[model samples]
Target: MTVLILGGTSEAVALDQLLADQAPEIRAVVSLAGHTSDPKPLNLPVRVGGFGGIEGLRHYLIENRVVAVVDATHPFAAIMPFHAEAACKAENVPLIAIRRESWKPRPGDRWRSVPDISAAVETLGKPPRRVFLTVGRLELPAFADAPQHHYLVRVIEPIGDRLPLNGVKVIQQRGPFEADEEEDLMRREGIEILVSKNSGGPATVGKLTAARRLGLPVIMVERPPKPDVATVDHIDQVLPWLVAQGIFVTERGV
Candidate 1:
């Protein structure tokens, strides 16, 4: 039986690893949106790029005879979750999402939450301040309007000429960064504010911690609403769900 995973996150990698080790009989494919130029290798077969839309995805599901789908896209992914929900329902396939929780402000966090990236730009106002941007390369264009501020952009992939800012420096790096390192970067760069999406994961939470230590104001872009579907926060729960669907075989006979 075939399973399709809408993947791009660390959680997706973990779930794929679990399936590879524990359920060898279940054939799984990991689908990426092709954002990262050099994504790390995975155990399962990986398909990069889009599935067109709902109609295209629906066709792929029917053609592949996929028994299930796991939506493990990024938290800020605004379209794919809805498309997956619609396509899976049409194909009569069991679908589940690994919806990671949003980060909440702690006692020392000086956060200013905004609905979206545009709002975050507006919050920066007319005054020029050194800003550290961790909201990915795709969202960088919106900051062009606020060109007065110096921006330190950290992305996994090269930004090229996407962000047309007057004073901006791009650092291509992937992370599970430490808080002390993050603090040092902020201090050295003279970052006055931080602009980040509420992409809740342990891999990149150090920036928030460092911001708290430095008492830097952060412009937190809240997550967009995800499609209402069967969801779990942890990757551990996925195998049991797959077993219950009768797609995963277990030696313990779960």
Candidate 2:
């Protein structure tokens, strides 16, 4: 009689709050990947770290009696959604993914879309450029191959000895940054090129807007393939879907 929420995004937090306020009888648990050391606290029951793999996840759904699962992880996440789909199927539990829409280029956006991170490095070319890197801490090492470019890396977690390049500057901060501030940073750093993942959320999208205003070329890394499952873009839609699934039954008569 529990709903397992695979959480890491802002959408997950909103959904958790919504359920807590509206569906008081339902037992909802938020599971985090533990990417950030000090993740924002949520009111619902929270579980941290991975469930090993697919077999481990399958065991969790069975043991916890998880009737449904919501995949609200980050778009850049490549593996977890597939694993959730498989595990939920194995357990005969319903699964839904909150697939945020990818950002489309506007009139002034100078974008070069590539399939993955490696291709992005290849796109950077041999000549050194002042690169604004926002693809997160996990994939920072990939830039090691293209060490000639100076990288301005911003991450939520401290990137200690992760990228051993000579001209790399690390800034640890959380986002939903203003476009004016983003523009100022880019101009001050003399950024020639911007490298970012098409993560498709407002929290970090100010970089793209700033880039567009400053007329900087962006090497956008596209999201990896995720398993096709029941999907929606917003958090508000989740509770209705759960109710429709009969996971949260309503009592009749007065």
lDDT score, candidate 2, position 212: 99
Model 2 residue 245 lDDT? Answer: 91
Residue 211 of model 1, lDDT score: 99
Q: Can you tell me which runs of candidate 2 are displaced by over 4 Å?
A: 250-254
Model 1 TM-score relative to the real fold: 0.98
Clashes of each: 0, 0
Q: Where in model 1 is the C-alpha error above 4 Å?
A: none
lDDT of 2 by residue, 1-254 (tens): 88999999999988988888888789999999998898888979999999989999999999999999999999988889999999999889999999899999999999999999999999999999999999899999899999899999999999988899899998889988989999999999999999999999788889999999999999999989999899999987887798789887556411
Note each model's CA RMSD in angstroms. 0.8, 1.7
Give lDDT: candidate 2, residue 101. 94
